[model samples]
Target: MSFPSFLSHRLSLVQEQQLELAVLAEHVKRGSGHMRRLALECLAQRQAELAADLAQVAQLAAPRAALRKEVAA
Candidate 1:
């Protein structure tokens, strides 16, 4: 084969490889975006649960404050 034909064949092979790489990159980006969204949702749910627990703790402590004040007087 001539040098020109050899280079042309190699160029076509490189192009095909580049196309495959682009497709793989896109797939990874989409998967990462989906995972990020799921993580954020899980974080929000955990925050809500913590807030509820804090509120319950505060409610339980309220009655104790009055009793302590009465004892101090």
Candidate 2:
């Protein structure tokens, strides 16, 4: 083939490969975004459960404070 045709052929191949790469990259980005959102939701739920447990512990300790003070005196 002529030099011009050869260059055009090569450019076309390169363009095809680049398009495929762009599609793959987009899919990866979408998957990563979805996974990150899922992880964040799980973490938020766990944090809320931990907060509730801590609050319950605090409430139970409140009534014991008077006994502690009497013992200290």
Candidate 3:
């Protein structure tokens, strides 16, 4: 149960990061000034990095969950 809960939390983090990146991308498209676009792009990149980290955490959590299930059986 804990492993499933942890995976769910990590997945939610990934979803949140992706949503932020989408918002940043919209700002990059609509930004009036060069600096604004540049800043938005940087933020989008950081969000992508965070999402990737969350994905890795999810992958790690998957095996733990499988092990726990097998142990219970």
The TM-score leader among the candidates is 3
Query: Which regions of candidate 2 are displaced past 4 Å?
Result: 1-31
Task: For candidate 1, write residues 1-48 as lDDT tens digits.
Answer: 874475556556555655554555555556567775665565556556
How would the candidate models be sorted by lDDT, starting from the highest?
3, 1, 2
Give the clashing pairs for model 1: none
Model 3 segments beyond 4 Å from truth? 62-73
lDDT of 1 at 50: 50
TM-score between candidate 1 and the true structure: 0.54
lDDT by residue for model 3 (1-73), tens: 6866867787887778777777777777777798677867788677769967876996788788889899999
Q: What is the C-alpha RMSD of each candidate to the true structure, in Å?
A: 28.2, 27.9, 3.4
**Which residue pairs of candidate 2 clash?**
none
Q: Lowest-lDDT window of 10 residues in candidate 2?
A: 20-29
Error of 1 at 33 (Å): 0.5
> Please, what's the RMSD in Å of model 2?
27.9
